[model samples]
Target: MKKLNCLIGAIIKDQNWAVIPFGNTILEPDDQVIIVTIPENASKIREMLEGGPVRTNHIMEE
Candidate 1:
């Protein structure tokens, strides 16, 4: 998530309380990770999370 300029604020597993995450934090398959970033970089951020670029169709009207 670093490549996307996103920060992992915390991680929550099961119903336990959230814990502050760090660079070396190990994310589990079911762990819920919270990230913080700006809105301008949302697309790129989402792409990073989704593992690839998301294709969008730009419709033109005449």
Candidate 2:
């Protein structure tokens, strides 16, 4: 996950088993992860989770 404001929802590991997770939380197999982000960083966040090459931050002042 990028260094942006992310709201992770409850993680359901098994039937009737769910808990709120934090940033430092470690995910386990069969864990359901939910995330909410802004439109601007949607692609960035997707690439990050997919383990793809992310674009570097650049400033282009017209």
Taken over the whole model, the C-alpha lDDT of each candidate is 0.46, 0.45
Candidate 1 lDDT (Cα, whole model)? 0.46
Clashing pairs for model 2 are: none
Off by over 4 Å in 2: 1-7, 17-19, 51-62
lDDT of 1 by residue, 1-62 (tens): 22333444555566675854544444444545565545655555456556433221221222
Q: Against the true structure, what is each candidate's TM-score?
A: 0.42, 0.41
Candidate 1 to truth, TM: 0.42
lDDT of 2 by residue, 1-62 (tens): 23323434455555554554545455444445555445665665455556422232321221
Q: What's the CA RMSD for each of the models?
A: 9.4, 9.7
Clash count, one per candidate: 0, 0
